[model samples]
Target: MPHILLVEDDAALAALIVDYLRAKGYQLSHLSRGDEVLPWLRQQRADLLLLDLMLPGLDGFSVCRLVRGISNLPVLMLTARNQHLDQIDGLESGADDYVVKPVEPRVLLARIQALLRRAQPAPLAELTRGQLHLQRSCRRATLGGQPLELTHSEFELLWLLAEHAGQAVSRDTMLQYLRGIEFDGLDRSADVVVSRLRRKLGDHPKSPEKIKTVWCQGYMLLPEVSA
Candidate 1:
């Protein structure tokens, strides 16, 4: 069962959400105050977080930022403030998504399920190619024994490539795997994402060795599975 940390101030609403989510087979931990969130999260492991914007002390945005700084755990902000700026602020603060107050229990559940699906970790068997080593469960990658700093998207892309190591992954295929949709008019965005990923992985686009660009095709992880 997926564990969720729910931070809400209203006792009645919190109870309702907890009951609904628990019925849906989610293991839930509730905290009414934002001040308690960090400590709770540090002590208990949760797959995702459902946070309310208005809380006693700290506020949800700050909590989201603090969590992002330490871990890439998925966050879904629940707010009564429907302003676009509030939503943007939540996202900028590292929330995966946001929901307005007076939310339908069903919709919240759907969003929670979607975020969990997107945040699923890669399989946890060792994957190595040359000096690159990826440990899926921990979401850690090292190149030549040096730790690699990767964003969530970059990690996912690397994991996908490693899964099919040595095979060419077309841009469309990668987009589908990453975004769950065809690039369509977002081809440039896909290229930009890949370019950023290459930079993070220390793979030069020109004369690349680890992740090779195949002209108009896509990318391939070099087949030398060592290190």
Candidate 2:
């Protein structure tokens, strides 16, 4: 059963949501104040979060941002305001999706299911391709038996490629994965980051087998022979 942390101030609404979700076989813990959310989250293992925009003590945006800094847990923002700016703000604040209040219980449940499915971790325990070895739980990667010093972005990029070894990942998809902000102007930036990562990984741009660039598509990480 998927566990969820629900942060909403409205007691009546929260109760209704909790009851509806419990009927769907989901386990949930509730918090009425945003200030309590982070502390509760630290002590609990939740599969997804249901966050309300308005709350006492830190607002939902701050809570969402803080949570994203530590974990990649999926968040669904529920708000009474139905403005485009509100939705944009929620997404920018690290919410996986946004839903306005007065929403159907069934609709919210469907969105929750979708987010849970997407947030599921890859099945592979250890990923190796060429000189790279990635331990998922430890979030550590080594190249040629030496630890590779990588930034957070670099590590995530390598992990995504290594996880899907030999399969081409489109540039658009990679950009979406790396930075939540997606704009056409940022395409060059993504390419630059990938180039720097390739150099750091000691991959040859001329005949790169580790991260192979597919013309007009994206890149692929060729699998290495395990010893």
Candidate 3:
């Protein structure tokens, strides 16, 4: 069963969602204030988070940003506001998905299931390809037994690429996986970040043997080069 931590200020709506989701076999824990979420998360783990936009102390956006810094757990934003800007803001703030208010219970459930599916990866404590190794627990990565100094974002991007070694993961998918948000069609930040990672990995863009860019697609770790 997938466990969900839901942060919503509305009592009635939270109860309805909890009951509905429980019936569908999902285990859920509820927090009525945004400020309470991080503390609760410290004591517990959840497969996903159902976050509402309007909250007492910290708003949903702030909560999402903070959570993204510490965890890769999927987040789905729930909001009564129907503005496109709100949706964009939520996504950029690290929400995996956003749903407007008055959503059908069935629709919400389906979305949740989809998010969970996307978030699921092979359960591996550590991932390795060739001379590269990544420790998921510590978020530390090394190449040829030498630590590759990487920022949090770089580590995540490399980890995802390493996890799906030899597969050309799309740019949009990369952004979503590493950033916990959707790609704005025009955003080339993923490319830029990949370039930086490549430099650190000593994979020249011209004749890369470690991480390779699949023309117009995304990136992949060279499976044959795995030492």
lDDT of 2 by residue, 14-129 (tens): 99999999999999899999999888878879999999988999899999999998999999999775577878898999999988888699899999999998988757778777
Across residues 75-101, which tens digit of lDDT does each residue of candidate 3 receive? 999967558887899999999998888
**Stronger candidate by TM-score (1 vs 3):** 1
* Candidate 3 overall lDDT versus native: 0.88
Q: Which regions of candidate 3 deviate over 4 angstroms? A: 123-227
The regions of model 2 sitting more than 4 angstroms off are: 123-227
Model 1, range 1-227, lDDT digits (tens) per residue?
A: 99999999999999999999999999999999998988887888999999998899889999999999889999999977457888999999999998888989988999999999999875468788777888887889988798888877788888888877888888788788878989675466556766876776676677767777777777888866333
lDDT (Cα atoms) of all candidates against the true structure:
0.85, 0.84, 0.88
In model 1, what are the clashing residue pairs, if there are any? 130-226
Candidate 3 to native Cα RMSD, angstroms: 15.1
Stretches of model 1 off by over 4 angstroms after superposition: 123-227
Order the candidates by lDDT, highest first — what do you get? 3, 1, 2
Query: In model 1, how large is the Cα lDDT of residue 14?
Result: 95
State TM-scores per candidate: 0.55, 0.55, 0.54
